[model samples]
Target: MYRTILVPLDGSGNANKALDIAAHLARANHARLYLLHVPVITEKNDDSLVTSPSQNDAAMQLIQTALETIDVSDLDTSILVRKGTPAEVIEREAHRLDADAIIMGYKGLGRTSNEKGGSVSAAVNHRAACRVVTVR
Candidate 1:
């Protein structure tokens, strides 16, 4: 039985599908859902990572939109917008939150895979300590 479920959203249709599945799982198990959106940190001319309000806003908006599409009104849910590599942030957050399971899309926005030939979901699946459910 799951007590805490984490779903990483990227505003992609697949990610939204994963959210729906996660919500169902959460409801069935009486679990809490943690929705996470990670905004990529851009590098400036000086090679310094920069985060702007707009970036954060976009992440929040993505989460909000996903929430609006899902029927999780009766479920306990938490939203988080963090700036970092999507895979790393999701992995760390799962550990930090002590999540029992993670449900996410198999592929997200942009490139299908990373430089290592694995997508963000793949990386999280390989590194996470808890159960990983990848929704196609």
Candidate 2:
């Protein structure tokens, strides 16, 4: 029933798995796929610096990389890159895109949850405006 699916990636294996799932779903349902990658931003000393590239620059590169990595030849796909907390950014973008569902990876770096879904996935499942499918 999903017309537009949002898939958040972090360049991790788990995220790639989610991408594959989203791609298949999009192909099956003839839906549009929105790929999002939230850059890893970290504070240095007292200044809040994006550990990744500058916002605009990093976003462009992230979108390019995401497109290159995903197999979207059979489905319509768009890329979005935003800077912020992963869960917050994903939720905001999903709403902004008016997506019908969000498909994302489960585990993340430094995650401690014994459950299949990681912190970000859990957060998105709780806060997103649409249905959240956390691929493990």
Candidate 3:
């Protein structure tokens, strides 16, 4: 039933697993995929400065690497790299793109949660306008 699918990746193994699922679903539903990578910038409470330029560069490289790992030769796909909170950016893009659903990985790199989904996944699932599928 999905037409436009949003896939948020963090360049982690878990995000790649979710990419596989999103790709399959896109193929089955004849849907287009929107790939989003958010380079989060964490700062000290003083908020004196944003993340270093080097950190942003590394995040961009990770996003490019993630793109290389996927084969979108047979699917309609779009890639975006943004700077913000992962969950907020994903949700905003989903609405902006009018995505029918969001497919994302539940596990995260350094965050932990008692729930199966990570903090970002859980937040997006709760705040998104459409359905959210979190792959473990």
For this target, which candidate reaches the highest TM-score against the unseen true structure?
Answer: 1
Candidate 2: residue 75 Cα off by (Å): 2.0
- The residue pairs in collision within model 3 are none
Question: Taking the candidates one at a time, how many backbone clashes does each contain?
Answer: 0, 0, 0
**Cα lDDT listed for each candidate:** 0.88, 0.78, 0.82
lDDT of 2 at 3: 94
Task: State how far residue 87 of model 1 sits from its true place (Å).
Answer: 0.9
Q: What lDDT tens digits, residue by residue, belong to model 1 across residues 57-128?
A: 888888989888898989999998876678888999999999999999888885645459888888898999
On the 0 to 100 scale, the lDDT of residue 68 in model 1 is 89
Task: TM-score each candidate.
Answer: 0.91, 0.78, 0.80
Comparing 2 and 3 by lDDT, which wins? 3
Candidate 2 clashing pairs, residues 3+ apart or interchain = none
Per residue, candidate 3 scores C-alpha lDDT tens digits across 94-136 of 9999999998888768563324455888989888999999888
Rank candidates by TM-score, best first: 1, 3, 2
Candidate 2, poorest ten consecutive residues by summed lDDT: 109-118
